[model samples]
Target chain A: MLERVDKAKKQIHNTVDALGRSVNIMEVCGTHTVAIFRSGIRSALPESVKLLSGPGCPVCVTDQGYIDTVMDLAAREDCLIATYGDMIRVPGKNGSLETMNRSNVHVVLSSDDAVQLACAHPDKTVVFVAVGFETTTPATAVAVMTAEKMDLSNFCILSAHKLVVPAMQALLSDTKNKIDAFLCPGHVSVIIGSDAYRPVVEQFSRPCVVAGFEPVQVMEGIAEICRQLADESPQVKSLYSAVVTAQGNTRAWELIEAYFEPYDGPWRGLGCIPNGTLRLKRQYKRFDALVRFGIEEIPKEEPNGCLCGQVLCGLINPPQCGLFDAVCTPDTPVGPCMVSSEGACSAWYKYGRRGKVHHD
Target chain B: MCLAVPARIVELMDDRGVADAMGNRWSVRTTLLPDVQVGDIVLIHAGFAIATVDEEEARKTWELFAEIAEFQERQAPSSKEEGTV
Candidate 1:
């Protein structure tokens, strides 16, 4: 395995050298960002090749308004708010769900847990803060289906789910960041399939490779991207064939479509993207927490000195921000990027790369 | 937020099942891929089995690595010969 990794590294180096120019590849998955940092793959790459973290972390990309809305829901005396663990720390305009001292806020492992909480509390309305990409949308769909099957009317979801491909298009359309290719999210590809990126490759003429979370898989995916650039042929490839197929999981997609529909939603760094957000379908409207509680979304601004927007765009690294290490450590994260474990800032801080100089 | 893992289904009770990966067991629902049975490896995320692993394609990916190794071997001797010349 070590020999194969060395060969892949050599191939990447050769391909980059042949190109004779900088090849910037953006990884659109937070798990990939952490895996790359933890495996020290960034340092091992050729200087001509650069890896940038994109808007893949769902929590980091979630708009400040969304957080404030969730916090407001948590504040209601009759409402029970259940969310994933990472979301509890994301700062809103007033404070985070954790710091607000709200006893109704519960950290759940899955949407199923939230459904169970609703079943247990028959009187109080349980609102599950659903947030993730296509990879996690199926689970939310299943949770919604389970709630319907069990006739749990008190259970509802505040959907903050975002689509991956639309956001990729948003990034590519931005002239400021010059991304040569993309490292597609592995788990998302399992649901949407490798062919889902066909539009991305066709429209933008950028190579997209669906990669696994393993170190060698990531290196191989990069090597493949470099090879594509060297050949001047932009295409979609899947290196994670063990789990991902050309068509992906059709049942999961069908379930998601049945329960949710695309809507223009706001992102933290990237503003409202066309068809970037997912909302409950008409049939599932009763389970919509936003409608049930009459919660209105209040526009909120990102905290001062938080460069999470620029960092998400790959325009700057975490250390480039003055607040990164000095005031924005993981223990007390002022920004959403530092709060989520999968966020680029959190990964950089945990891997001891906070003070070092990074690429532009 | 999109972290998922491949785990082998150790036990199945109707639609709900338990999968084991590296000694840890998780309760995963196989409703998405209901055809999955015990001993089959499935890609699990957020307490659900999203897809089954394609063993054939996985083998093909491994073969591609072997081909990469063979290509590297072929290129090494020619580059060395060029240096000597």
Candidate 2:
């Protein structure tokens, strides 16, 4: 594995040198962000090859108002919150779900558990905090389908679910950040397919390479991007074909189409993006938590001095934020970036703090 | 938030199946890939088998990595119209 990693590294350097210019490649998967840092690839790369982390972490990009709203739901006596573990520690306007220390809130591993909670408890309204990209969206859809099949009216989803392609499109259309190419999410590609990124590659003229989580896979993915730039060809290439395909999982997409619709969604720093958010379709509105509880999703600004938005856009690193380490450690994170394990800020805190980047 | 792992199916009944990743075991819904069998390996994401992994394709991907270097040396970038490394 080490030998193969070294071979890919040499190829990356050769390609970059041939191009005779520096390039910024963004890995648009939170898992890929952590993998890059953990594999020691960030520090091992040459100074000219800059790697930037994009808005791939669902927890990090979730709107602040949504956090406050979930906290509000947690405070209600008739409500029980079933959420993925990443969300419990994220701070909101008043406090976090974890700090409340209430028995009403429970961390669940899957949407299946959330539905089961609604079944087990006949009275309390069980609201699942659903947040993720396309890879996990179908799971929540399956949960909703199950609820409807079982005729369970007590279960609903407070969906902060986001789509990956639109977010990337929003980033490229904006002029501030300069990204040469993309290391697309492997699992996301498995669900959405490699062909989903064709618009980005064709419209924006950026190469998109899908990669797995291993060290060799990551290094080879970067090398592929560099080769594309050097060769002056931007195409959609799927390196992880064991699961990903040109068309992707059709059945999974069918489930998504049946349950959700596109709308303008709120993002922390990026603001509201058109067709960026997914909500339960009109037919499935009966299971919509926001509608059932009469909750409104008002946009809220980032906490005073939090740079999560800037970090999401690849404008700055986590350390560049004023509150990154001193005030926003994982134990007492001021922002979602530090709290989620797959977040870039959390990755830097755990593994990439000492790595040298192009900035250095 | 999208975390998925490859696990082999140990048991199957209709859409529901038990998947084993190494020593750990859990029930997974194979509704996406309804054709998946008890012994086939599939990628499990959030209690569902999203896609079946072809072990042959996985081995081929790594083998292609070795050809990447040769592909770089063989083809001249300016002359070619298309083909991935």
Root-mean-square deviation of every model? 9.1, 8.4
Q: Kindly give the stretch of ten consecutive residues in candidate 2 chain A with the minimal lDDT sum.
A: A351-360
Of candidate 1 chain A, the 10-residue stretch with the lowest lDDT total is A351-360
lDDT of 1 by residue, A160-211 (tens): 8999999999988899977999999988898999999999999999999999
TM-score against truth, every candidate = 0.91, 0.92
Clashing pairs in 1: none
DockQ, model 1, C-alpha based: 0.24
lDDT of each: 0.84, 0.85
Candidate 2: Cα lDDT at A62: 98
Per-candidate interface DockQ score: 0.24, 0.24
